[model samples]
Target: MMWRRRHIFDPFYELKRMEEWMNDLMGEMQTAGGLLLPESTGKEVAPISRVPSIDLIDKGDTLVLRADVPGVDKSDISVNMKDDMIEISAERKGEEEVKEEGYIRRERHYAKYYRAVPLPASVDKDAITAKFENGVLEVTMPKVAAEEVKKIEVK
Candidate 1:
């Protein structure tokens, strides 16, 4: 006679295995630049949006913000200002073609950037100015005058 050992099912063990698998999958997705899926044409597509690096500085009377937006034309950038927030968005499109002896290769690249920043103080939107030069965008916003608080005497 042959003896057989029965296996026991543990729900917790299954859950732990699922968690580990999920973590690994997420790590790979990030390394591959977000989730990629194949289209009907057999081409891989991924999300093309990114956040541009920026520097915000407060100079007492004004707030200066500098954002890096390389490979983007000035006409492709847009800046919107509200009482307490500023929004920046830009897009870049490029194409490259190469022809070697018997093969022709072409590639297209696209990039989109968006960022919204909240101001710590009220700004004078009418006096705000922006400049885009050498792939860098600089925005200067004047701070609104603060009202003086009057102290009351108590007996």
Candidate 2:
């Protein structure tokens, strides 16, 4: 006679599995809605985009721009200023565990973000200074002095 071991189902294990499934679903929805939520080190939840929100301020002598770029490496960010336009770009890489787990419902947060702002006045591109700290980027650009207008009399 062949004897087969009978499998026993534990209610607690099933409930825990269900909870995990529900959490994964909610995470997907959050990511789809373009939500940027805080990340927990214990377990990476839904990977939200790392696109930095920005604020541009027009000061008397300099144009100050602040961007909220969290969870992004400093080396992945770039800023460019040309004439009266400023461009900002950044990228975030997805977690390796999420990629390895092909069946798990996770937000593939590998994302690239780009933004351009037009200055209200001309600025000195060479004199621009930018600083990044605590996931925030601040850029200061000096404004060019206005040229004096000389009226010419036409005969």
Candidate 3:
């Protein structure tokens, strides 16, 4: 038996509702010079998107950032640590393709994506390390330990 996808709707797919939503959005975008639509594709070409697939482990005086960067070139990825922010950027290869004879309809296409994460505190920027392997980018930043003891001289 084929598995049926369950949506927040009746068994019948309510396609018209989706169509109406898209129409409303596109209509609003038209005034903005159709900014959402790319000139090359003549359709809505969304910029690269990204998701946070990471873990933060507190190890006394350090932290580990494991980011999921699948299907991207490690060389193109850049990791930056400044003040209280961890910036990552990369130019992934576009997924445009050529195909033949395999469509009654063609929609739900995908485009590149980008994701950025902001750090909470000033990480020890000098010790930031990045490792990219098996399509995952891992960043390790050692925290600067705060002063545990203070000595005050009486004057």
Clashes of each: 0, 0, 5
**Candidate 1 local Cα displacement, residue 140, angstroms:** 0.5
Per-model C-alpha lDDT, please?
0.85, 0.75, 0.64
- Runs off by more than 4 Å, candidate 1: 1-46, 149-155
Locate the minimum summed-lDDT window of 10 residues in model 3: 40-49
Distance from true position, residue 56, model 2, in Å? 1.2
Which window of 10 residues has the lowest lDDT sum in candidate 2?
40-49
Ranking by TM-score: 1, 2, 3
Candidate 2 local lDDT, residue 96: 44
lDDT-based ranking: 1, 2, 3
Which of the numbered candidates is closest to the native, going by highest TM-score? 1
TM-score of decoy 1: 0.67
What would the per-residue lDDT of candidate 1 be over residues 9-93, giving only the tens digit for each residue?
7788789999999999977886888644434221333477667778999999999999988889999999999669999989999
lDDT score, candidate 3? 0.64
Residue lDDT tens for model 2, 1-155? 97544486678878999999999987777868643343522223334333457888988998999987676788988999866799887777875434354475555556666566788888888899998898788999999998899999999
